[model samples]
Target: MSFTTRPEITGTFGVATSTHWIASAVGMRILEQGGNAFDAAAAMGFVLHVVEPHLNGPLGDMPLLMRKAGDAAPTVICGQGPAPAGATIAHYKAEGLTLVPGSGLLASVVPGAFGAWMLLLRDHGSLPLRAILEPAIHYARHGHPVLPRVAHTIAGLAEFFETEWPTSFATWLPGGKAPAPGSLFANPDLADTWERVLAEAEVAPDRAGQMEAARLAFYEGFIADAIDTYLRDACVMDAAGGRRKGVMTGQDLADWQATYEDPLSVDYHGWTVWKCGAWTQGPTLLQSLRTLSGIDLGAMDLNGAEFVHTVTEAMKLSFADREAYYGDPLHADLPVSTLLSAEYAEARRKLIGATASRAQRPGHIAGLERWAEAAVARAGRDLAAGPGVGAGEPTMAHLTERRGDTVHIDVIDRWGNSVSATPSGGWLQSSPVVPGLGMPLNSRAQMFWLEEGFPTSLAPGRRPRTTLSPSMAEGPDGRQLAFGTPGGDQQDQWQLILFLRLVHGRMNLQQGIDAPLFHTAHFQSSFYPRATKPGHLMAEPAFGEDVLRDLRDRGHEVEVAEPWTVGRLTAAQRDADGLLRAAATPRLMQAYAAGR
Candidate 1:
């Protein structure tokens, strides 16, 4: 079965992430309804919040970067949530909690994706907030089928269902079990919450008003109170959450506001890359691109050994800098200007070679700061066989977890304008809702450092650094593409590799997205406390045994993964002959490219 290379998906382009085909279909519908990319994206993002609660919710933070055709620079909408004023590292240690939480609880970060959606609508949108958000609201109320990814993630961690923690077995493991795909899953409470969004939109039908309604209903109103009460009961609400940690008093929610500011961006090889400022690690993307400057990566084929090897090494340099100097610039004094500086990139690029790197070096170029020397590494990494990270066994273990994929949409109007974004409440992996008020607080707050004085340490109104970076690139001759992925830390590696494949390797978008994929495993998990090693490669088996043997010869530790399986998700768009063409990664279920 071959997908024809056609450039007909125009007028609007949208992609829904994950195994939830219906939700992705909802996003495609917005474009079909004549909505622009932003509207489609906003709509798609809302659907994810409703159906993909395990990814994130009203509570998780969202750090976004975007650029349109006419804008001189991308606007930075810092949607990520801030730590409650009262949260502190001392509190976690005192409580005897591990503090380094994984996908579940303790993986909390500040959530702001929903607010970002409203912000985009206010800045540039033709559709009403109700229209844009209606799809998600309707779906949450009517119910949607369980996705394969959701079913598998849940089953893998059956212990979580058994835990007496705040997210008791009964809450997530309803019927004391994980829901399988094809099963009808419904959440009336979520339906009620989405309905409230419409109610608020009517109250202030304008953009700001719509946002106000959403912010008030989700953060300040009844939902806030319920979340506060839940946190208090769980004993995790330290001082950083707020002055009124108990039931999050009225004063706390009332103070919430959706904000926007000029995001920091740098020009690399004619493309403009933006990053969110001071509060989060938005600058890292720029730094990464900068580090790749003048590397002559075009000499290698996309996803080919040489190309993958060179880019991965370059990314490692950027990530090392990420660990050392990337953080809340407000407190840690990051070297953003210096890192993205032409001279600095020149220096960093020299450290990488066309040959594979044997091991990672410290981020001395970015300065000497580090996050506990030698404590960061990616998991299940093996350098052998190109890029793979599995033992090459087909786990007949059925996919059994249930969670919503991400929501992403990008648009280019006939007027030559554009909008690209991924709005998210997040997957449903967090603890169950606050009950009556509607929506779940982001359990992502726990992603921050539990140690005192760290740049990512918990603090009043401080945002956590994240890998959810929105990106864009332009050709020296004016050809361009704007794309991104929805897989947390994997977002960077996936987008980076895809871009290299499409532009540098000269492959079409589909070929770029479908080319064999691999991610370097040596780094600190931005979301967890796992150390991924340098030689580890999480890759598909289609490349064959010789490829794996070659990688092994080069000192790789290979882990063979099932083809078309992995957490990475990608999307793309390019304008040609007065129409915009797009493609979605078919590697995973439900990734579709639709427009017109």
Candidate 2:
């Protein structure tokens, strides 16, 4: 029998799993109350915003992957907001900045998570908006147990919040100090904010009208006004080491809207994997799968040196392509079809050699590689030379220090509605608190480049090439899986490891997630102060000493980490036999999965 942290949760009704136990319970409760996966997901999303404020907030961005009942394909609900009209490369350079700051006003985009969640709730969910908003409101008002890590994060930034961002200090530090862990910490302001939106929504005639009212309140009414009012006059310190006022106006929020689009997919063996378009790092996972499909991974020992080497090498090649090509498709010509094509995967597979390569080698894209080369040159000037390059923003620093990443949720309902969503960006440290809202803006602007001509170059109204990727795949046996994890560049890398185990090794959901994890940092980071480590690979010590030595012999710079220190993955699925299963990672002790 395969070892697993917890037995796979099987039920006939529905299942919900998330990085946090409370959020998962909230979702499961919704499902038990006859809500669909979309309804449960919406409630769970709001609950996450409340209970895991250090990891996510209402103003964050989310990209959802959902396959509704009877739909043949999955769709992407893109909540990733775009750059403001005044967010010009010239303006940033004029501000004495080389790269976008990882935090503060200048790093903000029009808030998109609220809109996206509402969109999901309005279209696919069965419950009224009140049901979705209540759980979060209760937690925010009545209080929830504060995670020790969240308290520590607040303590670490206490001085900065107090001296630099008084609004943050006032909101996070209730008594001029961080709240104790296990204490019931309440944010009455956030509760009031939600209540006000709900009140405005209730004035409308019906459910659809009520949702429309809430949308107007968020995007065009008071919420937008509050954000606009503060950003216009507040000049604050950012990750770039300078105090600057953001260029985003209320008009930017008014003009922006969340949208839905077809998910990009590729077939690997008999499995069909789905991901968001190039605008996200989602497609990178597909590209890696395509490359690995050409190799007979099933023949290799699952935990052997050969398996690790092959997967790592394949990931490196695909990430190199991400650096060279992936961007917002609306702004540039992203040859996504060509990139994920079998022909491209075949040619790229040849570059994987017995010995690990040290250079960042992007495959030749006829018209784009020259610009890609220039981008490499621009990025080559040691991003580490700058103060903020390589160092993530304040919230990102909290993530590394506390091992806190983004939040993910996977829900599968009896009716066959399945959703996988990764919601991130807004955290207490990502920006100053928005006064009465008791939340911060997202710093997603850091993903953009100041350099023009590159696919990911900064531009007005273009979505940032976000690293927040969620995944869904269908097996040959008609088993549908919705799974994802929360690691910046490591998201797809870890997910790939789990996937290979499931397909080639025939492991179940819990077995695959419970298996030891490894990832490479050989590509450029998506965060500010972007940096890359050539041929760098980190794996859990559970891989054994002999395997580690063999990897070293293969020319990989391997770093053995403590067991259970990497990859906080969660998953939910429904098999052809009508069995619903869910699993959550035990690594962080925070994640949980629940079902009937």
Candidate 3:
């Protein structure tokens, strides 16, 4: 029933990913060639935009956090854009808005990738921006396989081909059509942007200037003005708005701007973790992980009833916090101080059972009595599922979820330093195109609370809480580990479970990442809904009633998940001798790790 936590090995390790394994290989080469972790990670983060445009783009938001071995202080950066100060919650209310098309388009925030990446390089990277960007530039110009995931998403959104702003896809396509998987694709416009970023980095070589150029090229240039005109002219968004109708006006493009800033995070059970601040649901991940820690997770097998019950109860406890206090930390007085406190962790842990899990959370923390009451009031009720529900028909149950635009790259070098990063190309599927620019305007403005006066409502310069969290963990023995995922809300538990599997079960990086995973949406704010209820677990349907019985004894809802239900992307442990291993969920196609 007990699993032992093993010590982490030492050596250079790196994990970087593009939608394609080629980019992943490129980063591994950099690491082996003696580039630091940041350089390796930056290479992967930039190139994914070229190979996986439909999922992520240069136009979207980025949230990044990192820590070095034995370093008490951790640095955090936000890669997400902000709502224009002009975009108030009042805007949605005034317009009688029911929904916004893409979360990236809804974004009023300024894009922060330029600044965030520089900060990473400035502190952790060894090579110059020029050196780090070389790989991406090559990939952008030369091209790689049209991943099935990428091709499918773009084909589904073919309307984008006709949108007001020029799509870079056409440039990559050459024949003016999507290339089939395995066909070569290239991005000339992004190549130009890549050149500009490199030129800026060469000229100023400072974080502020280099990053600002990256921002300005997309926002204030011919691209931005045209898109502004289009949005103003069109009023409504669709493919024809650009090429056929000429509807979106330059004025609308002018109105569009990417947001930027350092998003907030908190410690759960004394370990540093990241969240998607105000606009997106990031804190819910932190709260659930902390709550889960209180239970005796090893009481049953990984898929057994007891394990499921304890996990779900903890999820319910944390859900209360997410629903109540999980908003932009700056906009409100979240009880984060108390939520992560030892007293609350212990209190939250006490409500679980080895037999049957409760379908709800307990008001264990004193300050959260109000939240507890609310949960009690709403007990047995299900929080509404967000957009993109019932999208499992496509490959990997990700038709909606896999419209992915975020990328994660983590690196640890032989020098005992590590870097964790998550970057974005604005959501290609939903963001509007400015007339001249090939990039899409971020639509994260939609992540704001649709209702009036919600804590996450848009305001001047306020950052949207996002699911784009990049995190690093250090073992109790000073051995270091870092990882992040693209699964929206599952980023938290998915990464947490992976970390625990390696530490608690002593699995290697691949085995740990490849292992079956379970989660409970009950009472928790998931990027996806359809939470597990009492007596259910989203597990491989291989375990027997004995496992379920044990979970019931602990008050869990253990449901059978299709085997291989989850595996978010990961970049960790730099060298094989070290922990630098890349682990994509086995469920995902063509995901693997490479290190030298």
Candidate 1 lDDT tens digits, 249-320: 334445555577777767766666555664544465676677776877776545456555666677777766
Question: Could you tell me the TM-score of candidate 1?
Answer: 0.84
Better of 1 and 2 by lDDT: 2
Q: Which is the better candidate, 1 or 2, if ranked by TM-score?
A: 2
Model 3 TM-score (2 dp): 0.79
Model 1, runs deviating above 4 Å = 1-20, 32-34, 103-110, 154-178, 205-207, 235-253, 266-269, 275-285, 353-359, 365-407, 423-426, 574-577
The reply for model 3, stretches above 4 Å from the true place, is 1-20, 32-34, 68-70, 99-104, 159-176, 205-234, 238-286, 353-402, 523-537, 542-562, 569-571, 574-584
User: Could you tell me the C-alpha RMSD of candidate 3 in Å?
Assistant: 5.6
Candidate topping TM-score: 2
TM-score of each prediction: 0.84, 0.97, 0.79
Candidate lDDT (C-alpha), each: 0.56, 0.86, 0.54
TM-score, candidate 2, is: 0.97
- What's the residue-level lDDT of 202 in candidate 2? 93
Question: Backbone clashes per model, in order?
Answer: 79, 2, 100
